[model samples]
Target: MAHIMITGGSSGIGLQIARLLVQRGERVSLLARDPAKLEAAKHALQSQYPDSRPVHIQAVDVTDGAALHAAVMDCVASQGAIDTLIASAGMIVPGSFLDQTAGDFNSQIDTNLIGVANAIRAVYPSMIAAGRGTITIISSGAALLGIPGYTAYCASKYGLRGLATALRLEAKPKGVSVCICFPPDTDTPQFRQEIAQRGPETKRFLGPPKPWPVETVAKHIVKGMDAGKGEIFFGFDMMMLDKLGPIIRPILEKAYERRNKKHIGAQEGR
Candidate 1:
């Protein structure tokens, strides 16, 4: 059993992954901003996997580099070396580019992009010194295409792709494997929050969000990690896009524009 640490593991896909890993006899550590949620998560995991190793929980905002580094060190000290580090912490604020404030954009960047980088940096030295480790980054389908209302989210996730690609090149030679997972709209607390603030054009274009369950997403991610795959695509459509994103982007953009125009026309008629 490996020692695994996951950021944002207090809930959603991150929590599910932690639970699954613990069930498989792995020692797991969870890091998030909320102490209450982290305690609750630990209780839930302990109840479900009574025979498993104790779950290590750390309350640290991913955006705070110093706090995050300290939290990571604590986990390593408690659980021994981290064999797997999953940088799953992220945030999203969707709106038209003009409507979204600069603060909103920067917040997403700090959490979704830079936060991941910081988490990686904290664990990287240990992994490199050990000469073996697995790093999984949770990018989104938004990384593939810039949707109508997810401009900032798209930018951050796209930046994650770049980070993973470059890191993979450097780490692969050193026995550290980097995997980036592109999960589509996932059924989580975060998704519910996004739904509450979704723009009409985005809602129409994406069509009544059918998010995949946390269990399903976690299953695929763990399987991919086991196989040591570099890129993990959750859905069939996502896989297709990963392969042909540039080729099909123009077509997708035209379709979205047509849909937006129709939605506007209907709104105007009303």
Candidate 2:
């Protein structure tokens, strides 16, 4: 059985992954921001994995490098060595570029980019020492295709994709594998909130109305981690986009801008 530490394990895809891992008899520890959410997640998962050890929860904001480092160490200490690390915590604040505050941009960078780097730095030593471990970074399809009003979110996830690619090269020699995923429109509370905040006027610009269940995404992630795959682009359309992203990115960006013209103009006029 492998010990896994998942950041953002309080809910959404992270929580789903934790529950699935526990059911498979793997030891799971969660690093999250809310004590109450962590405790509730622990209770909910523990009831499902009755034979497993009490689910470990460390309340640490991923943006805090010191706290994140300490939390990773604490989880590693309890679990012996981390067999897998999933950088699954991320946030999205949807709006036109003009509507985006400096804080909004910074928060996405801090959480989605720097946060992943921090977690890797914290656990990499032990993973390298062991000469065997896997990392699954929960990236998004937005990282591949630029979307209207999701500039900050896309930039942060694109940064994660770059980081994961670099880490894969560095960790290969150490026998550690990295699996980065491009999960498309997962039906989590986060996605719901993003849709609601985008409002009816701007929603059409998002294009396509399918948001997949978190459980399906979580299952693909676990399987990819097990296989040590380099990348997993969840869903058929996302796979196609992954293949064409490099060539079509520019055209796609122009199309997205055209779709959001009214919203962008409105935001700029505010």
lDDT of each: 0.93, 0.85
Question: Candidate 1's error at 213, in angstroms?
Answer: 1.2
Clashing pairs for predicted structure model 1, backbone only = none
lDDT of 2 by residue, 208-269 (tens): 55888889989988888777689997767678778877767777667666767876788899
Please state the error at residue 215 of candidate 2 in Å: 1.0
- Stretches off by above 4 angstroms in model 2 are 199-202, 250-270
TM-score of each: 0.97, 0.91
Supply the TM-score for candidate 1.
0.97
Off by over 4 Å in 1: none
